[model samples]
Target chain A: MSRRSFLRGCAAFGGVTALAASLAPLRELGDYTNTEQFLQKYYKELTPSDMTKVITRIEGEVERQYGIRPHVRDLKPMDGVEFVYALNLTRCIGCRKCVHACVKENNQSRSPEIQYIRVLKMPHGSMDVEKGNHNYDSKQVPEKGFFYMPIQCQQCKNPPCVKVCPVNATWQEKDGITVIDYDWCIGCRYCEAACPYWARRFNFTKPQIPKDKINPDMSYLGNRPRKQGVMEKCHFCIQRTRVGKYPACLEACPVGARKFGNILDPNSEVSYILREKRVFIQLKEEMGTSPRFFYYFDK
Target chain B: MAKLDPSAQKKSDHTANYWLGGLTAVFFSLTIFFAFNSKPHVAAQPEIPLVDKKFLDTSPWRQTYADLVKAKEDLSDYDCYACHDKAKPPRIRYDTNQKIIIPKEHANIEMSHGTHERNNICYNCHNEQNLNTLQVRDGNVVKFDNIPQLCGSCHGPTLRDWEAGAHGRTSGYWDRQLGDINRLSCANCHNPHAPDIPTREAAPGPHYLHEASSHEPSKSHR
Candidate 1:
């Protein structure tokens, strides 16, 4: 063969090998399609029979992977119930008990350390979150002129995260909780960028929860074992809250700084806080996304 | 183009069209009926009880105070009757000769409620007649659980806030339908002798990316 033809042949072989190597990852995509997950419909679009089949398939998959039977359900929001949260700034003693409680209850990824609640220690008189410090390691809290403010997914009524989702994966529920369908999320992280509170977290790796520490009480739209490359945030503890129980963070708070309840109920604690105390939402002037979470000080 | 009966041909065509139309109508009606009649696909919410009643019962303050009071009120070791009978006890009098003198038996007790000079005596809070119980402004004897009423005699506003679920820790349930709501008594959080909540090491804060680098003391202090 001529030298030019021989070089062309060599180049052709190299191109073919590189192409084959890159396409090898497509086999994993093929595996997803082969399973029942590819046939899964959008959460809102699922028919009764489709839901049953999808849930059963997920149960089987979880059992195969985790070696533990998880009871995963798609809990519906109750009618006339708008959940609201209020934190007493004066009462919060800069204790990070709520942060760890959220991690355990929500089945957050343990390896890279994802916590829903971020307690920011702000200077005593300032409300500016920009000046707020999240990594304050003071020896004793309420450090003279500083107060702790814990921030979580505000569960906004008009969430920017939901708006920016390329796939209709994340959306606000009727009860005002913004939930992500782990199966449906494309892991684009657009929602993460859109969120103002830094509430959304992207799972970089498949969550490595200890088999013993795994929260078996899982919900489909809430704290079920999330796969890698999906965005997850606080769903107001849908597994517990939908069943008429308080969120884990509220139970874990040592100083009773957190308060949560259905705002529609006239007698609910949240309603009383809104009506009585000097209550305000974070970024209230932002105007578009009306967050259900409120911060208040005692009168 | 064979010679045929026109009426018969027409009749056959009419019958076929009628049957076709009738079938389409039936199919559409069935679809509509099924669409409307099918029940909503509400995912079966398993009745999983979320709250652990046992965990709720274990209040941080309740157990501590209960244990503390139980240890002090161990009647087997120290009896209140040994010092005073059922009749009203005498008012504590300070001897002019001595600059400061608490009873030798009660010397170990610390009276740090307000100040050393103001209302430092035991009779101020404790019912002299019954050393074991507390006393309210109305002279009504209050139980340990009802210490708030005694504290309310002076700190009325705080008592009101506590009742309104503002001043203290409330756990268990916000909606009373699921479980009993628990409110911590004043003694649960505050020591009766030392009213101020003591300082303690705060829990570790969030360690976000570059958070350590961003902690500038000069900027934060400003």
Candidate 2:
């Protein structure tokens, strides 16, 4: 049988051979990527074995393109660790440094729809969080009792997105983060509707990041560039967290307010914060999403 | 010339009886073979995974492995229920006693088979081969040292922040060269089965640590 036909048969059976068939087309198109940047993938098409080859090729391409041999492979998923994230609302400057870092770290579509982080500017006296907006373009710490609340997926324990998936395309892992299988999703919006944070965003168009800025260190569901018409959200930096590293947002936070660690480990910093500081979750009374993120307002 | 012979009549009857006996034997043998090969699935059984009321009586929200084992031992010899029926769907159970409904952000979000469900169910992600590794299910096949990238299927934004070093667990400094340990799966920060209540309250802040002398009108201005 032709490779495409063979791949179709493999897909019917559910395996990586089908993925190889789809990847074959990309190899031909690899020449088109003169900029030597990263390519996106459908999550279901790849297996762990396929991912290694893809990662190696990407590293070679990154070296060929940028001449910088980054420790990309060393940053792959490890065997026993569980990664988690935390944000301290007390010190965010509203400078959006983390937002810029995310844009650069992941080859995100510049389209306003694909923004991973939305820095909401709240008014000075009103803590009625409902008033924040992503469109506010005023100066830094723009006047009055205003503070910044960077809104994104809270990575809740009982993700509404995971529960409502008809095809079981999205789910939570042992480490506490929720993920999606790009290939398995039939473009159904059930997960989006179920998300109380409105954290889920649909990709209406294939993401277009400048070729030079593509981050080579990517995981299937993490930093890898995505195609059009799929739903995606925050990954908690799976590529870095898989190793003993920090996320892009935490590194970029200027005030050092964000803290991330294992809630399972009582000795961790997040655990300490949970113990010592009085923390509250947003919209705690409705859908029961146990978010890992925390916001502390300072008087 | 001869109208009918008794011997000829006897020969015809014998031939007909032989064909009928062969057909009956073949039919019965085929039926027995098919019956054995096709594993019997009782269609009469309802769609619910558990038929026993005892298992259902224990917990309305979550199912335990012990319960699964009990249900399997009680129902069938195959123990199918041990693996399939034991799936404890993560849900948000509002504690009316605390006067708190689980937050929507903390609730089970519907993911259309794109995330964990797309992978084999709870048993598939967690190792089932060895019962000795008990308590929380461990992901053996897709073994991630830390939180697996599997969480990013839906939480790409948080994962991105984690990568950029913003949201999750972190050291005091941002290092692009080194990877971060704080980035985790959905379960790292939150519970899969029990929806955790959002306990943090909004505290007021004058958060920025401004350089003390920067705003104090410079000596030149004075």
Candidate 3:
């Protein structure tokens, strides 16, 4: 054979080999081998009856897997309400109570370490996020001159993550929380890359949640068990918050540093923070994400 | 159509049959190989223990007014009239350092509120005439449930922030129309005597998958 023909043959062989190798991981997906899930309709397309069936299927699957019958439902956003968060930098002591509280409440994989909130231990003067350390070892909190800044999904008005999704799996809800449909997500990781705050967590392997530790209260778009290929971020505890309850993080905070409420309500705590307090930080405001989460100082 | 070439035709047909038979044998063998040999992969669950319950608890340890009201039995500790006289006013005592010595009977009360030692007096908050009632700086008597009014007289900014839901913890519904709201009073979280918050044990840091499995045991959170 001529040189050009030999090269073409090699290229074809290499392409076939690469394609075969890419599909090898699919063999390990035994638990998700159900044909029923593959045939299920999209989130919005599912009618009320369809939703009930889907919820039942989910409940059955979770009960079979974890031996706990979880209460799963799709919580729709309430009308005339826009959620916003105000974190007091002055009062925060870097206790990390919110982090673990979120984990317990959200049913995040405990072993593979999926956490929604990350409190940055920053030195007194610096405002740059890069300077903050996440792995600070200390006996107690509010140590000396150091201040804490807890970061989570900002639930931005204009989210870059949503813009980059190849599949329309993740979107901002009416109540200003961005949610992900685990069933529909194709796991491109484009949203993970697009997030400025490093909020999105991709499951590199199958998530390993302990049976007893799993929060049985789960919502379709919130703390529901995400598969290996999907992405998950903070949904402001949709399971609790949608039913007119405070997020676990807010309830857990010992210092009362974290504040959350409807921005539409003029009397809300978050509104009061924005109006009266010197609420200055939006965290990457220059990125134009228009995050609903705000940080403020006492002085 | 060519009947004279039957023997040649038969030989060619036999060769084609052999080829077809070999292909069919190979296909069946491959199917058997896959069906018998390829066990469906199941991911092994990692054996990572949950963190201690000390870290998982998120609720505030302090008692709210509603909680106090609900537990009527726990209210005996706050009953001042049970021990003190109701008719006579408690006499105010000041030492040379302008600090009132905490009486032996009130050993649980730690009266170090301000740097100036001026707010340590019992009458600063407590009603002198009626020990059951608490008084503000304005000499107005306030109930135990309305302790925020008395705290507001001294901590004006903090009280304002608390009223606006900016400074303290508020549980229950953010939407007032839907559910019951629980706004914690001043005494719920802070001790009126020593207003400064103590540094307690913090929760454990994140345990990454690849990192060392066990975390150093931290102190229990109160």
Candidate 4:
């Protein structure tokens, strides 16, 4: 071969080697995306043994990372139970105890803090949520002309978030709770956009919870530690409620403003509220989500 | 020769038909007898009784409140019987204008439930005869847990609402069959003397990614 042609070939070979070296990091990024995670079946599609394997794997991962053994369970919904929540506006003293209780119960990320309940301080005479300030920093609450209204996942019968999911990760349970499979989620943010109440929260980073604060009693579909880039919302405290316990938020409200019960049971507190009180739901006219959460004023 | 035996064959066929008829009759008789003799099944009783009379009856509102308070933590520290054992405490002497004479012991208590112009006496709700118990409008004594009855005498509508799980807080199981349920008493959230819950500092607000951007409009307008 000619000397000039040899020189040109060497230059081309050097350029190709440099380009391949720079692209090596992109290939390493693919290593972080586990093939096992990608190939994992949907939550409902998993067989009993497959579910056990997934649960065990999750438990191991959590134990390794957080140095705490999480009791991950896959609790199924009970029959003849439809949960409903009611808030007495007159009784809510604007104390946000419910918010922190929910965070603690749900194993929410403590650093980039995530809270399910958002209590809005609205003007006393108005019912508009837009005018409501969730960031009120006043010294004393029930501030002269203000009333508190807490907003959380309504667990709608016809959830808009479930409808917008590209991957069928989010679905409504038999007991009227909408749940998201963190593993199955694609981080599309479609559910976040579709939710009218702003109930959904996107995990921007891997949840960083202290070892001691991690709620060991977690359900696979509920308060289990979530991966980065997934959507999560309130699942009606499924870890507790599925086992016939009250939601953490209801137990935390000092003023006794919150009421939760099975709507199907005639003797349940929620049934009494719905039957007797002039109960009204938030954003009723807006998309007809038929939310189970209700707000009412008592005389 | 074949024609001679035809009558005999017919006789045999008639005998077979008679036997079949008798068997059908016996079958029908047995069916009729069994159908009439069988007894109807009764429904099994529910594991937990459905009717909770406390939730249903509203006549003696004090009883309902007592049942609710039973599930809650008792106020062991606030023992009224510590001072009053048997005899009723002496009444606080009042002036002609109905101004209360503050006793040395009760000097700390400032009664301000009703407006200043109205002559609101502590004895109106307190049992003068028994200092440990509270008094209803009809002068009946009620336990501290049943203080709702005293409050309800004036606030009838609120009592009704509280009974129906519309006014107060309810915690625990939605299905009371599964676990215990608790409904807060009137005194649990409100001070009976003042009745007005004071305002207090609320919990911290949401810290979101775009919180700064969202608050700009409200700040500029304000």
Find the candidate with the highest TM-score and give its number: 3
Off by more than 4 A, model 4: A1-35, B1-88, B93-101, B108-110, B114-119, B214-222
What tens-digit string does per-residue lDDT give for candidate 4 at B59-98? 2122333554565645553556676555766666887978
lDDT per residue for candidate 1 within A1-299, as digits (tens), equals: 96445445555554555455545556555323345787677899999889888878777777776788989888999888899989998788876777777878887766556778888889866788988877676767778888888988998888889889999999888888889999999999999998889999987655666676677788889998888788999998999888888889887776777888899997777877788788855554475788889898875
lDDT of 2 at A237: 73
TM-score (C-alpha) between model 2 and the true structure: 0.47
Q: Candidate 2, residues B1-222: lDDT per residue as tens digits? A: 878999999899777666555555554555555445444332231121211222112112233333445466443423434544355433324354432343564356332233333432444333454422322333434323233354553456655545544443344322223443433334434434332312221211111112225533222110
**In terms of lDDT, which candidate is stronger, 2 or 4?**
4
Candidate 2: docking tier: incorrect
lDDT of 3 by residue, B86-112 (tens): 887767676888777667787787787
Judging by DockQ, tell me the better candidate of 1 and 3.
Answer: 3
TM-score of chain A of each: 0.90, 0.73, 0.90, 0.91
Candidate closer to the true structure by lDDT (higher is better), 1 or 2: 1
Question: How would you encode candidate 4's per-residue C-alpha lDDT over A39-63 as one tens digit per residue?
Answer: 8888888999999988898888789
The best candidate in terms of DockQ:
3
Going through the candidates in order, their DockQ values are 0.13, 0.02, 0.28, 0.15
**Which residue pairs collide in model 4, if any?**
A141-B200
Error of 1 at A185 (Å): 1.1
Worst 10 residues of 3 chain A by lDDT: A3-12
Q: Rank the candidates by TM-score, best first.
A: 3, 4, 1, 2
lDDT (CA) per prediction? 0.74, 0.53, 0.82, 0.75
| Residue-wise C-alpha lDDT for candidate 2, range A1-299, written one tens digit per residue | 76445444434443343334434445444433433223434445567776676667656655664565434442333444444455566556675656656656665664332556667777766656577755554433533477677877778877888989998778887776687755456668888898877777776544545465567676655665565557888777767665555667776554455666666655555666566555654544356786766665422
TM-scores for candidates 1 onward, in order = 0.76, 0.47, 0.83, 0.76
